[model samples]
Target: MPITRRQFLAVAALTVSVREPRAYAADQEQAVFWRAAMPGRNANVLFGYARIDASLVPDIVSDGKRLIDETQRIIAAFPNVEMTAWDLPRRTLPPIWKSISRPVADELRAALAGLPDGVPIEELSGIEVSWLLMGEGQTPPNPYLGDVLARHSRSRGRPVAFLITEKEIREQFWLPRDPIVLNDTIDEPKIAFLLDVRRRVGPIGAHLEQLYRARRGEEIYRFTAEIANQGIPDPSTFIEEEKAGALAFDRLLGLLDSTDAPTAFVVLPIGILTGETGILPRLRARGCTVTPIV
Candidate 1:
Protein backbone atom coordinates (compact mmCIF):
# COMPACT_ATOMS: atom_id res chain seq x y z
CA MET A 1 0.00 0.00 0.00
CA PRO A 2 1.13 3.57 -0.75
CA ILE A 3 1.70 5.94 2.14
CA THR A 4 0.29 9.47 2.18
CA ARG A 5 2.56 12.49 1.71
CA ARG A 6 2.15 13.52 5.35
CA GLN A 7 3.15 10.10 6.65
CA PHE A 8 6.26 10.08 4.47
CA LEU A 9 7.33 13.44 5.88
CA ALA A 10 6.92 12.13 9.39
CA VAL A 11 9.24 9.26 8.64
CA ALA A 12 11.69 11.62 6.95
CA ALA A 13 11.83 13.76 10.09
CA LEU A 14 12.55 10.71 12.26
CA THR A 15 15.32 9.52 9.89
CA VAL A 16 16.94 12.97 9.90
CA SER A 17 17.41 12.83 13.67
CA VAL A 18 19.57 9.72 13.32
CA ARG A 19 21.62 10.83 10.29
CA GLU A 20 25.32 11.44 10.96
CA PRO A 21 27.03 14.76 10.28
CA ARG A 22 29.88 13.20 8.34
CA ALA A 23 28.42 11.56 5.24
CA TYR A 24 31.46 9.35 4.49
CA ALA A 25 32.02 7.96 7.96
CA ALA A 26 32.11 4.13 8.29
CA ASP A 27 30.45 3.91 11.71
CA GLN A 28 27.93 1.05 12.09
CA GLU A 29 25.63 3.23 14.22
CA GLN A 30 24.21 4.86 11.09
CA ALA A 31 23.20 1.46 9.69
CA VAL A 32 21.49 0.56 12.95
CA PHE A 33 19.47 3.77 12.85
CA TRP A 34 18.39 3.06 9.25
CA ARG A 35 17.30 -0.47 10.12
CA ALA A 36 15.26 0.84 13.05
CA ALA A 37 13.59 3.51 10.94
CA MET A 38 12.44 1.10 8.22
CA PRO A 39 8.61 1.36 8.10
CA GLY A 40 6.29 -0.87 6.07
CA ARG A 41 4.62 2.12 4.45
CA ASN A 42 6.69 2.91 1.33
CA ALA A 43 10.29 3.47 0.23
CA ASN A 44 11.55 6.99 -0.51
CA VAL A 45 13.01 7.85 -3.95
CA LEU A 46 16.24 9.79 -4.62
CA PHE A 47 17.32 10.89 -8.10
CA GLY A 48 20.53 12.60 -9.27
CA TYR A 49 21.92 13.99 -12.53
CA ALA A 50 25.06 15.94 -13.35
CA ARG A 51 26.80 18.18 -15.94
CA ILE A 52 30.42 17.88 -14.89
CA ASP A 53 33.47 19.91 -15.89
CA ALA A 54 36.41 17.68 -16.78
CA SER A 55 38.91 20.38 -15.85
CA LEU A 56 37.66 20.47 -12.26
CA VAL A 57 36.58 16.85 -11.80
CA PRO A 58 39.08 15.15 -14.12
CA ASP A 59 37.68 11.66 -13.78
CA ILE A 60 34.06 12.52 -14.59
CA VAL A 61 34.01 11.01 -18.10
CA SER A 62 35.28 7.59 -17.05
CA ASP A 63 31.84 5.97 -16.68
CA GLY A 64 30.83 8.37 -13.81
CA LYS A 65 31.90 5.96 -11.00
CA ARG A 66 33.00 8.81 -8.75
CA LEU A 67 29.77 10.71 -9.25
CA ILE A 68 27.83 7.51 -8.48
CA ASP A 69 29.83 7.09 -5.28
CA GLU A 70 29.11 10.62 -4.11
CA THR A 71 25.42 10.12 -4.88
CA GLN A 72 25.39 6.94 -2.80
CA ARG A 73 26.77 8.88 0.16
CA ILE A 74 23.97 11.39 -0.19
CA ILE A 75 21.36 8.61 -0.37
CA ALA A 76 22.67 7.19 2.90
CA ALA A 77 20.79 9.98 4.67
CA PHE A 78 17.54 8.19 3.87
CA PRO A 79 17.25 4.91 5.72
CA ASN A 80 15.93 1.76 3.89
CA VAL A 81 15.17 3.73 0.75
CA GLU A 82 16.15 1.99 -2.48
CA MET A 83 18.09 4.14 -4.99
CA THR A 84 18.45 3.76 -8.74
CA ALA A 85 20.34 5.48 -11.59
CA TRP A 86 19.19 6.51 -15.06
CA ASP A 87 21.30 7.29 -18.11
CA LEU A 88 21.08 7.98 -21.83
CA PRO A 89 21.38 5.08 -24.28
CA ARG A 90 23.63 4.83 -27.36
CA ARG A 91 23.02 6.68 -30.65
CA THR A 92 22.36 4.87 -33.95
CA LEU A 93 21.93 6.00 -37.55
CA PRO A 94 18.67 5.91 -39.50
CA PRO A 95 18.20 4.11 -42.84
CA ILE A 96 16.96 7.20 -44.66
CA TRP A 97 18.97 8.24 -47.73
CA LYS A 98 19.80 11.50 -46.02
CA SER A 99 20.97 9.74 -42.84
CA ILE A 100 23.14 7.37 -44.92
CA SER A 101 26.72 8.61 -45.29
CA ARG A 102 28.34 8.83 -48.73
CA PRO A 103 30.55 5.80 -48.10
CA VAL A 104 27.73 3.64 -46.79
CA ALA A 105 25.50 4.68 -49.67
CA ASP A 106 28.17 3.79 -52.19
CA GLU A 107 28.64 0.39 -50.56
CA LEU A 108 24.90 -0.31 -50.56
CA ARG A 109 24.55 0.77 -54.20
CA ALA A 110 27.42 -1.47 -55.22
CA ALA A 111 26.03 -4.38 -53.26
CA LEU A 112 22.61 -3.99 -54.89
CA ALA A 113 24.15 -3.75 -58.35
CA GLY A 114 25.95 -7.06 -57.82
CA LEU A 115 22.71 -8.94 -57.12
CA PRO A 116 20.24 -10.09 -59.82
CA ASP A 117 17.05 -8.10 -60.39
CA GLY A 118 14.86 -10.69 -58.63
CA VAL A 119 17.34 -11.48 -55.85
CA PRO A 120 15.82 -11.52 -52.37
CA ILE A 121 16.37 -8.38 -50.30
CA GLU A 122 16.83 -10.65 -47.31
CA GLU A 123 20.35 -11.39 -48.56
CA LEU A 124 21.41 -7.97 -47.21
CA SER A 125 23.37 -8.32 -43.98
CA GLY A 126 22.29 -5.09 -42.31
CA ILE A 127 18.72 -4.16 -41.43
CA GLU A 128 19.21 -0.59 -42.66
CA VAL A 129 20.37 -1.74 -46.09
CA SER A 130 17.46 -4.14 -46.59
CA TRP A 131 14.95 -1.48 -45.58
CA LEU A 132 16.51 1.13 -47.82
CA LEU A 133 16.57 -1.16 -50.85
CA MET A 134 12.92 -2.05 -50.51
CA GLY A 135 11.93 1.55 -49.74
CA GLU A 136 10.21 3.64 -52.41
CA GLY A 137 11.75 6.82 -53.83
CA GLN A 138 14.12 8.59 -51.44
CA THR A 139 12.18 7.73 -48.32
CA PRO A 140 12.54 4.51 -46.32
CA PRO A 141 9.89 1.77 -46.62
CA ASN A 142 8.85 2.28 -43.00
CA PRO A 143 9.87 4.45 -40.05
CA TYR A 144 11.84 1.68 -38.35
CA LEU A 145 15.14 3.47 -38.86
CA GLY A 146 13.61 6.75 -37.84
CA ASP A 147 12.17 5.24 -34.67
CA VAL A 148 15.45 3.57 -33.70
CA LEU A 149 17.40 6.71 -34.46
CA ALA A 150 14.95 8.79 -32.50
CA ARG A 151 15.19 6.55 -29.46
CA HIS A 152 19.00 6.49 -29.59
CA SER A 153 19.46 10.23 -30.20
CA ARG A 154 17.08 11.22 -27.43
CA SER A 155 18.64 8.89 -24.85
CA ARG A 156 22.31 9.57 -25.50
CA GLY A 157 24.23 11.04 -22.51
CA ARG A 158 21.36 11.16 -19.95
CA PRO A 159 22.10 10.54 -16.25
CA VAL A 160 21.23 7.71 -13.82
CA ALA A 161 21.53 7.14 -10.05
CA PHE A 162 22.75 4.06 -8.10
CA LEU A 163 22.02 3.03 -4.50
CA ILE A 164 24.97 3.19 -2.09
CA THR A 165 24.18 0.34 0.25
CA GLU A 166 26.46 -2.35 1.67
CA LYS A 167 24.16 -5.06 0.32
CA GLU A 168 23.93 -5.27 -3.46
CA ILE A 169 20.68 -3.82 -4.83
CA ARG A 170 20.20 -4.00 -8.59
CA GLU A 171 17.55 -1.61 -9.75
CA GLN A 172 17.77 1.12 -12.42
CA PHE A 173 15.68 3.33 -14.71
CA TRP A 174 16.43 5.07 -18.04
CA LEU A 175 15.29 8.65 -18.69
CA PRO A 176 15.01 9.14 -22.43
CA ARG A 177 15.16 12.59 -24.03
CA ASP A 178 12.14 13.90 -25.86
CA PRO A 179 12.19 13.82 -29.67
CA ILE A 180 13.71 16.91 -31.31
CA VAL A 181 14.61 18.16 -34.78
CA LEU A 182 17.60 16.19 -36.01
CA ASN A 183 19.39 18.02 -38.85
CA ASP A 184 22.18 15.58 -39.64
CA THR A 185 23.47 17.52 -42.63
CA ILE A 186 25.07 20.46 -40.87
CA ASP A 187 28.71 20.73 -42.04
CA GLU A 188 31.90 21.48 -40.13
CA PRO A 189 32.26 25.18 -41.03
CA LYS A 190 28.75 25.95 -39.86
CA ILE A 191 29.30 23.77 -36.82
CA ALA A 192 32.48 25.69 -36.06
CA PHE A 193 30.58 28.95 -36.49
CA LEU A 194 27.77 27.75 -34.21
CA LEU A 195 30.24 26.51 -31.61
CA ASP A 196 31.95 29.90 -31.70
CA VAL A 197 28.61 31.65 -31.35
CA ARG A 198 27.66 29.44 -28.39
CA ARG A 199 31.00 30.10 -26.69
CA ARG A 200 30.82 33.86 -27.29
CA VAL A 201 27.17 34.62 -26.52
CA GLY A 202 25.74 31.43 -25.05
CA PRO A 203 22.50 29.90 -26.45
CA ILE A 204 20.55 33.07 -27.11
CA GLY A 205 17.69 32.60 -29.58
CA ALA A 206 18.16 35.94 -31.34
CA HIS A 207 21.90 35.46 -31.70
CA LEU A 208 21.45 32.01 -33.27
CA GLU A 209 18.93 33.41 -35.75
CA GLN A 210 21.23 36.27 -36.67
CA LEU A 211 24.16 33.96 -37.23
CA TYR A 212 22.09 31.49 -39.27
CA ARG A 213 20.73 34.27 -41.49
CA ALA A 214 24.24 35.48 -42.26
CA ARG A 215 25.09 32.25 -44.13
CA ARG A 216 24.35 31.76 -47.86
CA GLY A 217 22.10 29.01 -49.34
CA GLU A 218 24.98 26.90 -50.63
CA GLU A 219 26.86 27.36 -47.37
CA ILE A 220 23.88 26.07 -45.44
CA TYR A 221 23.67 22.88 -47.56
CA ARG A 222 27.38 22.36 -47.21
CA PHE A 223 27.09 22.81 -43.46
CA THR A 224 24.13 20.47 -43.29
CA ALA A 225 25.97 17.81 -45.27
CA GLU A 226 28.98 18.14 -43.00
CA ILE A 227 26.84 17.68 -39.93
CA ALA A 228 25.20 14.68 -41.58
CA ASN A 229 28.64 13.25 -42.29
CA GLN A 230 29.51 13.85 -38.69
CA GLY A 231 27.00 14.17 -35.87
CA ILE A 232 25.59 17.28 -34.16
CA PRO A 233 28.68 19.47 -33.51
CA ASP A 234 27.50 19.83 -29.96
CA PRO A 235 24.32 18.22 -28.61
CA SER A 236 23.82 21.18 -26.29
CA THR A 237 23.28 23.55 -29.26
CA PHE A 238 19.96 21.86 -30.08
CA ILE A 239 16.88 23.02 -28.13
CA GLU A 240 15.91 19.37 -27.90
CA GLU A 241 18.77 18.67 -25.50
CA GLU A 242 17.24 21.09 -23.03
CA LYS A 243 13.83 19.57 -23.55
CA ALA A 244 15.34 16.18 -22.81
CA GLY A 245 16.36 17.43 -19.38
CA ALA A 246 12.78 18.40 -18.66
CA LEU A 247 11.57 15.06 -19.97
CA ALA A 248 13.96 13.35 -17.59
CA PHE A 249 12.48 15.28 -14.69
CA ASP A 250 9.00 14.35 -15.84
CA ARG A 251 9.97 10.69 -15.87
CA LEU A 252 11.29 11.04 -12.35
CA LEU A 253 8.07 12.64 -11.20
CA GLY A 254 5.98 9.92 -12.83
CA LEU A 255 8.05 7.27 -11.10
CA LEU A 256 7.46 8.95 -7.75
CA ASP A 257 3.74 9.39 -8.35
CA SER A 258 3.21 5.75 -9.23
CA THR A 259 4.63 4.60 -5.92
CA ASP A 260 3.48 5.05 -2.31
CA ALA A 261 6.63 6.97 -1.41
CA PRO A 262 6.03 10.24 0.44
CA THR A 263 9.02 12.26 -0.75
CA ALA A 264 11.32 12.20 -3.79
CA PHE A 265 14.66 14.00 -3.67
CA VAL A 266 16.32 14.82 -6.98
CA VAL A 267 19.94 15.95 -7.33
CA LEU A 268 20.98 17.63 -10.57
CA PRO A 269 23.90 19.75 -11.72
CA ILE A 270 23.72 23.37 -10.62
CA GLY A 271 23.86 24.52 -14.25
CA ILE A 272 20.89 22.36 -15.31
CA LEU A 273 18.82 23.30 -12.26
CA THR A 274 19.09 27.14 -12.62
CA GLY A 275 19.14 27.86 -16.36
CA GLU A 276 16.25 29.01 -18.59
CA THR A 277 15.89 25.39 -19.75
CA GLY A 278 15.94 24.15 -16.16
CA ILE A 279 13.12 21.87 -14.92
CA LEU A 280 13.45 22.60 -11.18
CA PRO A 281 10.53 25.02 -11.28
CA ARG A 282 8.35 22.45 -13.03
CA LEU A 283 9.23 19.85 -10.42
CA ARG A 284 8.34 22.29 -7.64
CA ALA A 285 5.07 23.18 -9.38
CA ARG A 286 4.18 19.50 -9.17
CA GLY A 287 4.73 19.62 -5.36
CA CYS A 288 8.20 18.04 -5.25
CA THR A 289 10.60 19.33 -2.58
CA VAL A 290 13.72 20.58 -4.37
CA THR A 291 17.18 20.78 -2.75
CA PRO A 292 20.36 21.85 -4.53
CA ILE A 293 23.54 20.11 -3.34
CA VAL A 294 26.49 22.02 -4.70
Candidate 2:
Protein backbone atom coordinates (compact mmCIF):
# COMPACT_ATOMS: atom_id res chain seq x y z
CA MET A 1 0.00 0.00 0.00
CA PRO A 2 1.13 3.54 -0.68
CA ILE A 3 1.62 6.21 1.97
CA THR A 4 -0.87 9.08 1.89
CA ARG A 5 0.01 12.78 1.96
CA ARG A 6 -1.37 13.20 5.47
CA GLN A 7 0.78 10.29 6.54
CA PHE A 8 3.81 12.06 5.13
CA LEU A 9 2.98 15.22 7.08
CA ALA A 10 2.48 13.29 10.28
CA VAL A 11 5.82 11.58 9.78
CA ALA A 12 7.51 14.86 9.03
CA ALA A 13 6.04 16.40 12.16
CA LEU A 14 7.36 13.47 14.19
CA THR A 15 10.89 14.15 12.97
CA VAL A 16 10.66 17.48 14.78
CA SER A 17 10.65 15.71 18.11
CA VAL A 18 14.04 14.09 17.67
CA ARG A 19 16.72 15.63 19.90
CA GLU A 20 18.79 17.98 17.74
CA PRO A 21 22.50 17.26 18.01
CA ARG A 22 24.54 19.55 20.22
CA ALA A 23 26.81 22.11 18.55
CA TYR A 24 30.22 20.86 17.48
CA ALA A 25 33.27 22.46 15.81
CA ALA A 26 32.83 20.37 12.63
CA ASP A 27 29.10 21.15 12.55
CA GLN A 28 29.91 24.86 12.33
CA GLU A 29 32.02 24.27 9.21
CA GLN A 30 29.41 21.89 7.77
CA ALA A 31 26.80 24.63 7.65
CA VAL A 32 25.55 25.05 4.08
CA PHE A 33 26.61 28.42 2.64
CA TRP A 34 26.33 30.19 -0.75
CA ARG A 35 26.37 33.83 -1.79
CA ALA A 36 27.02 35.91 -4.90
CA ALA A 37 27.16 39.51 -6.09
CA MET A 38 23.81 41.04 -6.97
CA PRO A 39 22.72 40.70 -10.57
CA GLY A 40 23.29 43.59 -12.90
CA ARG A 41 20.67 45.32 -15.06
CA ASN A 42 18.13 43.08 -16.83
CA ALA A 43 18.00 40.50 -14.04
CA ASN A 44 14.58 39.66 -12.54
CA VAL A 45 13.56 37.68 -9.47
CA LEU A 46 11.06 34.88 -10.09
CA PHE A 47 8.46 33.88 -7.48
CA GLY A 48 6.47 30.66 -7.82
CA TYR A 49 3.28 29.92 -5.89
CA ALA A 50 1.27 26.70 -5.55
CA ARG A 51 -1.69 25.81 -3.34
CA ILE A 52 -1.03 23.13 -0.73
CA ASP A 53 -3.60 20.34 -0.48
CA ALA A 54 -2.98 16.87 0.84
CA SER A 55 -5.71 15.38 -1.35
CA LEU A 56 -4.19 17.01 -4.42
CA VAL A 57 -0.65 15.86 -3.75
CA PRO A 58 -0.02 14.96 -7.39
CA ASP A 59 -0.99 18.41 -8.59
CA ILE A 60 1.22 20.02 -5.96
CA VAL A 61 4.14 17.86 -7.04
CA SER A 62 3.54 18.75 -10.70
CA ASP A 63 3.54 22.46 -9.88
CA GLY A 64 6.88 22.11 -8.07
CA LYS A 65 8.41 20.31 -11.04
CA ARG A 66 7.19 23.03 -13.36
CA LEU A 67 8.77 25.69 -11.15
CA ILE A 68 12.08 23.81 -11.17
CA ASP A 69 11.98 23.40 -14.96
CA GLU A 70 11.36 27.11 -15.45
CA THR A 71 14.13 28.01 -13.02
CA GLN A 72 16.63 25.77 -14.85
CA ARG A 73 15.65 27.37 -18.13
CA ILE A 74 16.31 30.82 -16.68
CA ILE A 75 19.70 29.76 -15.32
CA ALA A 76 20.69 28.33 -18.72
CA ALA A 77 19.92 31.64 -20.38
CA PHE A 78 22.23 33.60 -18.08
CA PRO A 79 25.99 33.00 -17.82
CA ASN A 80 28.09 33.40 -14.67
CA VAL A 81 24.91 33.34 -12.59
CA GLU A 82 24.53 31.52 -9.30
CA MET A 83 21.05 30.34 -8.27
CA THR A 84 19.78 29.34 -4.86
CA ALA A 85 16.55 27.43 -4.09
CA TRP A 86 15.05 27.78 -0.62
CA ASP A 87 12.43 25.34 0.67
CA LEU A 88 10.11 27.09 3.11
CA PRO A 89 9.79 24.81 6.12
CA ARG A 90 6.52 24.19 7.96
CA ARG A 91 5.82 25.92 11.33
CA THR A 92 3.65 25.28 14.35
CA LEU A 93 1.66 27.90 16.24
CA PRO A 94 2.84 28.64 19.73
CA PRO A 95 0.51 28.63 22.77
CA ILE A 96 -2.62 30.71 22.27
CA TRP A 97 -2.49 34.27 23.61
CA LYS A 98 -4.98 33.38 26.35
CA SER A 99 -2.16 31.56 28.04
CA ILE A 100 -0.09 34.73 28.23
CA SER A 101 -2.00 37.98 27.61
CA ARG A 102 -5.52 39.32 28.10
CA PRO A 103 -5.20 42.18 25.64
CA VAL A 104 -4.37 39.75 22.82
CA ALA A 105 -7.38 37.63 23.68
CA ASP A 106 -9.66 40.67 23.53
CA GLU A 107 -8.24 41.60 20.15
CA LEU A 108 -8.75 38.10 18.79
CA ARG A 109 -12.33 37.98 19.96
CA ALA A 110 -13.09 41.21 18.11
CA ALA A 111 -11.20 40.26 14.94
CA LEU A 112 -12.71 36.79 14.72
CA ALA A 113 -16.29 37.68 15.55
CA GLY A 114 -17.21 36.50 12.05
CA LEU A 115 -16.15 32.92 12.65
CA PRO A 116 -18.81 30.28 13.14
CA ASP A 117 -20.30 30.31 16.61
CA GLY A 118 -19.33 26.70 17.24
CA VAL A 119 -15.68 27.41 16.52
CA PRO A 120 -13.34 27.38 19.51
CA ILE A 121 -11.79 30.83 19.41
CA GLU A 122 -10.26 30.34 22.83
CA GLU A 123 -8.09 27.54 21.52
CA LEU A 124 -6.41 29.81 18.96
CA SER A 125 -3.89 32.59 19.47
CA GLY A 126 -4.66 36.03 18.07
CA ILE A 127 -2.27 35.41 15.17
CA GLU A 128 -3.79 32.03 14.25
CA VAL A 129 -7.26 33.52 14.32
CA SER A 130 -6.12 36.31 12.03
CA TRP A 131 -4.58 33.83 9.58
CA LEU A 132 -7.76 31.68 9.49
CA LEU A 133 -9.88 34.71 8.68
CA MET A 134 -7.45 35.65 5.90
CA GLY A 135 -7.32 32.09 4.58
CA GLU A 136 -11.05 32.45 3.96
CA GLY A 137 -10.36 35.66 1.97
CA GLN A 138 -11.70 37.91 4.71
CA THR A 139 -9.63 40.87 5.85
CA PRO A 140 -8.60 41.05 9.45
CA PRO A 141 -8.11 44.37 11.26
CA ASN A 142 -4.80 46.11 10.62
CA PRO A 143 -3.79 43.56 7.99
CA TYR A 144 -0.16 43.80 6.86
CA LEU A 145 0.85 47.31 5.89
CA GLY A 146 0.81 48.10 2.12
CA ASP A 147 -1.22 47.28 -0.98
CA VAL A 148 -1.84 43.86 -2.55
CA LEU A 149 1.34 42.18 -3.85
CA ALA A 150 2.21 40.51 -7.17
CA ARG A 151 0.07 42.94 -9.11
CA HIS A 152 2.09 42.15 -12.24
CA SER A 153 2.35 38.43 -11.65
CA ARG A 154 0.48 37.73 -14.87
CA SER A 155 1.82 40.58 -17.05
CA ARG A 156 5.37 39.39 -16.38
CA GLY A 157 4.66 35.99 -17.97
CA ARG A 158 4.97 34.23 -14.65
CA PRO A 159 3.14 31.00 -13.77
CA VAL A 160 -0.64 30.89 -13.70
CA ALA A 161 -2.13 31.97 -10.36
CA PHE A 162 -4.03 29.02 -8.91
CA LEU A 163 -5.09 30.64 -5.63
CA ILE A 164 -5.62 34.20 -4.42
CA THR A 165 -6.26 35.57 -0.95
CA GLU A 166 -8.10 38.86 -0.31
CA LYS A 167 -5.76 40.34 2.34
CA GLU A 168 -2.04 39.49 2.27
CA ILE A 169 -1.09 40.24 5.91
CA ARG A 170 -3.88 37.99 7.07
CA GLU A 171 -1.40 35.46 5.74
CA GLN A 172 0.32 33.54 8.52
CA PHE A 173 3.82 34.52 9.71
CA TRP A 174 6.25 32.75 12.02
CA LEU A 175 9.98 32.68 12.79
CA PRO A 176 12.07 30.43 10.50
CA ARG A 177 14.55 27.78 11.56
CA ASP A 178 18.12 27.77 10.19
CA PRO A 179 18.50 28.28 6.45
CA ILE A 180 19.73 25.62 4.02
CA VAL A 181 20.44 25.77 0.28
CA LEU A 182 20.74 22.84 -2.17
CA ASN A 183 23.08 23.29 -5.14
CA ASP A 184 22.47 21.49 -8.43
CA THR A 185 26.17 21.19 -9.25
CA ILE A 186 27.09 18.88 -6.38
CA ASP A 187 23.69 17.62 -5.25
CA GLU A 188 21.90 16.79 -8.50
CA PRO A 189 21.05 13.23 -7.46
CA LYS A 190 19.99 14.43 -4.05
CA ILE A 191 17.79 17.03 -5.67
CA ALA A 192 16.16 14.39 -7.84
CA PHE A 193 15.59 12.22 -4.83
CA LEU A 194 14.05 15.12 -2.90
CA LEU A 195 11.59 15.75 -5.73
CA ASP A 196 10.75 12.07 -6.03
CA VAL A 197 10.16 11.78 -2.33
CA ARG A 198 7.80 14.76 -2.41
CA ARG A 199 5.94 13.11 -5.30
CA ARG A 200 5.46 9.99 -3.22
CA VAL A 201 5.02 11.49 0.23
CA GLY A 202 3.78 14.99 -0.58
CA PRO A 203 5.26 18.34 0.55
CA ILE A 204 6.33 16.97 3.90
CA GLY A 205 8.73 14.65 2.09
CA ALA A 206 10.35 17.72 0.57
CA HIS A 207 12.28 18.17 3.82
CA LEU A 208 13.14 14.49 4.31
CA GLU A 209 16.67 14.62 2.93
CA GLN A 210 17.51 17.72 4.90
CA LEU A 211 16.17 16.23 8.10
CA TYR A 212 18.19 13.07 7.48
CA ARG A 213 21.30 15.12 6.85
CA ALA A 214 20.83 16.77 10.26
CA ARG A 215 20.79 13.25 11.71
CA ARG A 216 17.09 13.30 12.53
CA GLY A 217 16.17 9.62 12.61
CA GLU A 218 13.45 8.29 10.32
CA GLU A 219 11.19 6.73 12.92
CA ILE A 220 7.77 6.62 11.27
CA TYR A 221 5.91 3.82 13.02
CA ARG A 222 4.14 5.99 15.58
CA PHE A 223 3.45 8.77 13.12
CA THR A 224 1.96 6.30 10.64
CA ALA A 225 -0.46 5.01 13.24
CA GLU A 226 -1.33 8.50 14.41
CA ILE A 227 -2.17 9.75 10.92
CA ALA A 228 -4.13 6.61 10.18
CA ASN A 229 -6.43 7.39 13.07
CA GLN A 230 -6.59 11.15 12.54
CA GLY A 231 -9.45 12.99 10.87
CA ILE A 232 -9.26 16.28 9.01
CA PRO A 233 -8.83 19.26 11.32
CA ASP A 234 -11.27 22.16 11.31
CA PRO A 235 -10.66 25.17 9.09
CA SER A 236 -9.12 27.10 11.97
CA THR A 237 -6.63 24.30 12.60
CA PHE A 238 -5.73 24.17 8.92
CA ILE A 239 -5.04 27.89 8.85
CA GLU A 240 -2.90 27.61 11.94
CA GLU A 241 -0.66 25.16 10.12
CA GLU A 242 -0.16 27.77 7.38
CA LYS A 243 1.09 30.50 9.73
CA ALA A 244 4.69 29.27 9.48
CA GLY A 245 4.56 29.80 5.71
CA ALA A 246 4.43 33.55 6.31
CA LEU A 247 7.67 33.39 8.27
CA ALA A 248 9.27 31.43 5.43
CA PHE A 249 8.52 34.31 3.06
CA ASP A 250 10.11 36.77 5.46
CA ARG A 251 13.21 34.58 5.70
CA LEU A 252 13.49 34.46 1.89
CA LEU A 253 13.31 38.23 1.70
CA GLY A 254 16.13 38.50 4.24
CA LEU A 255 18.25 36.22 2.06
CA LEU A 256 17.52 38.33 -1.01
CA ASP A 257 18.64 41.43 0.84
CA SER A 258 21.91 39.81 1.93
CA THR A 259 22.92 38.30 -1.42
CA ASP A 260 24.29 40.10 -4.45
CA ALA A 261 22.40 37.82 -6.82
CA PRO A 262 20.41 40.34 -8.86
CA THR A 263 17.68 37.77 -9.43
CA ALA A 264 16.19 35.07 -7.19
CA PHE A 265 13.49 32.49 -7.82
CA VAL A 266 11.46 31.52 -4.73
CA VAL A 267 8.95 28.67 -4.78
CA LEU A 268 6.43 29.37 -2.01
CA PRO A 269 2.86 28.53 -1.06
CA ILE A 270 0.41 30.64 -3.09
CA GLY A 271 -1.02 32.46 -0.08
CA ILE A 272 2.38 33.82 0.96
CA LEU A 273 3.16 35.21 -2.50
CA THR A 274 -0.20 36.94 -3.10
CA GLY A 275 -1.15 38.17 0.36
CA GLU A 276 -1.03 41.78 1.58
CA THR A 277 2.02 40.92 3.68
CA GLY A 278 4.01 43.50 1.72
CA ILE A 279 6.50 40.91 0.46
CA LEU A 280 6.08 41.84 -3.19
CA PRO A 281 6.22 45.53 -2.45
CA ARG A 282 9.27 45.17 -0.21
CA LEU A 283 11.13 43.14 -2.84
CA ARG A 284 10.33 45.64 -5.58
CA ALA A 285 11.40 48.55 -3.37
CA ARG A 286 14.77 46.85 -3.07
CA GLY A 287 15.02 47.23 -6.89
CA CYS A 288 14.31 43.58 -7.67
CA THR A 289 12.47 42.73 -10.89
CA VAL A 290 9.76 40.55 -9.39
CA THR A 291 8.07 37.87 -11.52
CA PRO A 292 5.74 35.44 -9.83
CA ILE A 293 5.44 31.77 -10.91
CA VAL A 294 1.93 30.45 -11.23
lDDT of each: 0.30, 0.31
Worst 10 residues of 1 by lDDT: 28-37
Q: Where in model 2 is the C-alpha error above 4 Å?
A: 1-63, 70-250, 257-265
Q: Candidate 1 regions off by >4 Å?
A: 1-55, 58-233, 236-247, 257-259, 262-274
Identify the candidate with maximal lDDT: 2
Can you write out model 1's per-residue Cα lDDT over 134-197, one digit (the tens) per residue? Answer: 2212211133221232233234432333222223222221222222133234333333443343
TM-score of each: 0.26, 0.26
How many residue pairs clash in each candidate at the backbone level? 17, 9
What's model 1's lDDT at 33?
Answer: 8
For residues 131-198, what per-residue lDDT tens digits would candidate 2 score against the true structure? 24223321221321111122223334444321223233233321222222111121223223323333
